[model samples]
Target: MTDTSSKPILILGGTGKTGRRLAERLTAKDVPVRIGSRSGSPRFDWEVPATWGLAMQGVGAIYISYYPDIAVPGAAETVGAFARLAVANGVTRLVLLSGRGETEAQRAEEMVKASGADWTILRCAWFSQNFSEGFLVESLLGGEVALPVGNVGEPFIDADDIADAAFVALTEPGHVGQLYELTGPRLLSFADAVAEIAKAAGRDIRYIKVSHDEFAAAMAAHELPPEITWLLNELFTEVLDGRNEALTDGVQRVLGRAPKDFSAYANETAATGIWSN
Candidate 1:
């Protein structure tokens, strides 16, 4: 055994998708888990660095899943500084949730690797959960989805697989200093993904491909928070330019299995009555 029983693991962004799943998985394995959130016991907050140390106390491993994303401005500095502190506080291993094709996220990954702690980076593609748990949820439930993405095929990844990959890296010994580009086994365009979701949900759904300006205007009309709206627009416009259309064998390479299919995710999520008529 690797003797992780000596100290608990701190999971940053424990309320978010990957973090939440990671926490659940770790807890299921009887690994002591400390949720690093403002609502947690020690109350870890990324915007407020003072809280980090308190939450990190007695933690030997950390699952660093930054909210919004590591691609956001100032995330690299925040993560870098926190990694140093976590290592100083006796954290021995770190698993970072990073974004695919994101230069900024790549910078943060490098910082984690240089933190003098055992590190594994799960560089993931756009998540399949976006339609069920994130931005596209409402639109999917509304029967029409509009986006700036057009004909750009993305190997949309499952958060569950991301969590699984993180589990292996966090608990295993041979995964140190590795960057795994985690993605789904197949590629699907935005429209194709929505169509799959619609079929799974047993509802008639439509996808509208619009210009970036139009998408931004629609989001503004919905009173979406300005910063979030700006970020979403930037991601769709700048990041979805066919940069992540290709597939990879990262899931197989890491876990000895292929990544989950989008259809499976759609069907499973639909069974939850998320997009019910």
Candidate 2:
């Protein structure tokens, strides 16, 4: 048996959504953890290859949550290179957080598989935390969340569930070579989601549909950085085109329970007072 007790689990993007939650869970279980992020100790930046070696040292497994989106150009090459490097450095396990319906992300998955490491792929849909903890939080706080989406429903999974599944993949057996498509129990349009938040938050919030060009112009008018604006535009125009409207049972298959509902998520998050301001 591999002596995993002495080896720390490396969590890339460890300060971000899923990675942070995973790190917390592992720590509670007394599993050694090394955070791999630009701000983490030893400073691991995906753009800086020199930091990877130090971060990978003494790491037995890795939970990889790529910054930005994996659908961007050159992401597959970078993932492939990183996977090869991990294997060369004796890292044995990898759990990749990927995107649903992204061809480029699928390519990156293949690279991890070919790298000779025990790997599990979590191809996830949009996250429910986007409203409470991510880019959409600002729009939610503004009362009117406007976007280019037009009645397209997305099965948004909870970040906590993703973390749970990732923990099992990292520490447990029998998950190697598995590709799990994780999604919520049902689908909800952006408008439906906002309405649920409004109900839960006891406030009036509106969801406005706009043309892609108009949305881009609004982002520019807000003086958002060009790179972020371009990425959001691509996500709205390309990724949210009803390609991932269906729900999946990956969470149930992996965790053996129904994934949490959006209403439950909205209610719990609203109670936290994050949407109040």
Candidate 3:
């Protein structure tokens, strides 16, 4: 059995959305945090096996937030190998940031579960930050957010809520062997979400519905890498096929509070001036 009492917590993607927030929260609580990223001190790269052991040194727990996404090809194998390595390096706890309604992500989740580490899976919905902090931000700035989506509603969870849940899972003892399907308090269509942002930002933003092929062509025209274009296309088509329309009690279950609504996210993010040019 691994002794986690004094070991530093390893957070992969420590500078990313949820990872960054979790790291901040943990650090504020005086928890020893080892950021694991290609650019971090004692760099940890998911594609480079040679760097794993160094980051794993004295790490009692790990937050696995795969880059690109876990739904991409070969994510399961890579995550599985990493989990095994964590066990070998004396890491006893694993918290995986996963995607809801993704078969590939589920496969990766299974690999983490079987890794012999005390595991907690945070299977989450589309992030509310996607508008302000991610790929859609440029579109929001341009006043037009076009996508290959229609009336399908998604329960967009706040990344902060995800970070909070992860913090609990990593530090608390009751979360082991639990799978938390995190979602927002309410569901909103892509168009509805844009409208909320527009209302919050006091701007005119149009939500244009384009065909999947057309969206792909536009992304390619913008010179996005082929892999990224492919991943976006897959997520827009397959993952958003009305599969994750309902709200889950993950936030309430884990944190004993209702998840933040999209309106709150939009309002708070609008204050940051991310939507304004």
Candidate 4:
């Protein structure tokens, strides 16, 4: 009932996990979609400001999923300026994918709130896909995953649920001016998560818990891009230190069901052979 029949919906990061899912869902429902990626026609690149006007042309709503994360350097400024542009170009609604416990992400959220557009914020914890779809994939394939996080259990969220929440926020009416802190129904430590993957995949995977120093050193040795390495270090050493242990009902509150558990995600993704040899 939100009357989007008149404007194209721009999905930033439309090729990434959440954005891709969101675009699919919207298109399935016959909502108009414009994928905002460097490769798309009328391309959208966060690093390039000029491309934004083309992406925003005829867009009435936006799903802003910043790559590398809103916590990365310059993300807030870039998202802030983009929001201003969207409002200037007649974008009336925005739903931003933000990181939980990230001050930089919060700064970007503030920008959206002040953009004078109707908005919803989905503040997400570390994703369960980190193992199946994200940085954990290479380490799992290599037989060992290492991180600074130890006993701190993160309530890992599903990108599917994040996408669902985003869809509702973008298409529904009451979600305006709300912030949903989305997490799974239960908490699991990194070791437990790895073990769950192993159980699901029928493989022996090892999770190596190291001191923050050792983890950073190993990341440097791997020659990861400096920014990505720094983000990994900061997220593990700073954000994963028991700051987000408790579970929330945001998923249920938003979508009328509990979030999918890590066990469920592990089993489903394993069935797809993503974790298999």
Candidate 5:
């Protein structure tokens, strides 16, 4: 276990997908963790800057996982401010969960680097958990997964792999000032991924390629939050257009092992019955 100087590592967005898993791993290793969420003590809100000071108190390091996304407009400034605040408060070790190929995400990465902290950026591809643990679960359970993307291949990384990489980055030495681009071992289209899940779950799941407008209409019908609707539409349209198709060795570089394949993730998550009808 890495020494934290008796101060907890604060995880921003600690209740979120990757943050939650990272918290579990840290706690299991006897590392003290302070969850930075709306429901957490002292209540860390991204929109409310006052709560940030209390959360950073006596923390040796911090895992920065921005809520909603780092791809949204003005996210760079917000994250930059938080990073500066963390550094000013004597918390220098900053690990940011970033996105690949998004201009805003890139900008936010630059901001973190400019903060004069020991920063490591995990520039990641699409998460495999988006299917089972995210908005697509309802559609999969309904027997069909519809999206606006075509045959563009994506190296969908597993959230567990991300957590493991982050664990190494946060707890170990020599990761300072590293920017890791993480991806799964296989290049899988959304349809191909759904098929893998279907095979694993022993169910007849269909993948439908809908138009962009059709996707927006579907999200609207579900009455999702405006930010979520816009984020999904933007992701399925702009971000999924073959920009992040290739695989990277970030996982292997960080963990000294190949990333978990999509098939393996499908099989394991299916066993959890998340995709079962």
Candidate 6:
């Protein structure tokens, strides 16, 4: 049997939330990795097809984490083309980080499946890191997290746990052809999530439920890019409409243990003082 770990694994969006954590785990195991990012050495850019080939050279596997998000328009085609390219370049193993309750996400999964490569799909719920490391970070620092959704629960998984799962799929065998619906052990509303963060940070952060129009106005006031504005709107209006509220045992199935709870994520993140101004 070939030592797959000895070959380089190209991690797209390698500097991102889950990708970076996954890279750390792979490096700890002495597995070689090539960061597939615009800023990486080979400069892998989804917009530039030329860069993709260079980055995939000699790579045995790939972790595809699309930029901005995979739920955006044309994302399926983009990811499909990338997967096809990886296969054509003689790299067959692939792992994808996807969002739960997303149409485009599932479409991209089908594209990867059709690529004729060994694939593992991790359809994930919201990331607990969003409050500390993502768009909500600003809202947390600003003392308020206002959105359009109300009472809709989301099972937010920890990124570290996600990294661990990806590490297993990439280095260990028997993960191909599997689709893991990764989520935390419990569900929490956006307000509930904020309250947990507040408790951990020992600060008074408020989460207010607003109308979709109000949320759009706030995004406009912040001057976020048009695509980002669109993504946020779609997530709040369509996807979060009680579709992915149910919890899953995906993390346990993949890693042989329960996924981290959101409260635990809050407590650990608070100690890092990222929530502290």
**Whole-model Cα lDDT per candidate?**
0.87, 0.90, 0.91, 0.88, 0.92, 0.92
Compared with the true structure, what per-residue lDDT tens digits does model 4 show for residues 220-243? 788999889978978987788888
TM-score of each: 0.97, 0.97, 0.98, 0.97, 0.98, 0.98
What tens-digit string does per-residue lDDT give for candidate 1 at 161-272?
9999988887777888788999998899989999999999999999999988888789889998766886787688778998888999899989999899999999999999
lDDT of 6 by residue, 134-188 (tens): 9999889889999998999899999998899898999888899999999999889
- For residues 182-217, could you state the per-residue lDDT of candidate 3 as single tens digits? 999988999999999999999999999999888988
Question: Which ranking of candidates, highest lDDT first?
Answer: 6, 5, 3, 2, 4, 1
Candidate 6 stretches greater than 4 Å from native:
1-5
> Native-vs-model 4 lDDT?
0.88
- Steric clash pairs (candidate 3): none
Per-model root-mean-square deviation over C-alphas: 1.3, 1.2, 1.3, 1.1, 1.2, 1.0
Lowest lDDT 10-residue stretch of candidate 2: 1-10
Cα deviation at 149, candidate 1, in Å, is 1.0
Model 4 backbone overlap count: 0
lDDT string for model 5 (1-277, tens) is 2347588889988898999999999999889999999988868999899999998898889999998899988899999999999889888899999999898999999999999989999999999999977888999999999999999999999999999999999899989999999999999999999999999999999999999889888888999999998888778878998989898999999999999999999999999998876
Candidate 3, 103: how far from true, in Å? 1.3
What's the CA error at residue 98 for candidate 3, in Å?
0.3
Alpha-carbon runs more than 4 Å astray in model 1: 1-3
For candidate 6, the TM-score is 0.98
- Report backbone clashes per prediction: 0, 0, 0, 0, 0, 0
Q: Model 2: what TM-score?
A: 0.97
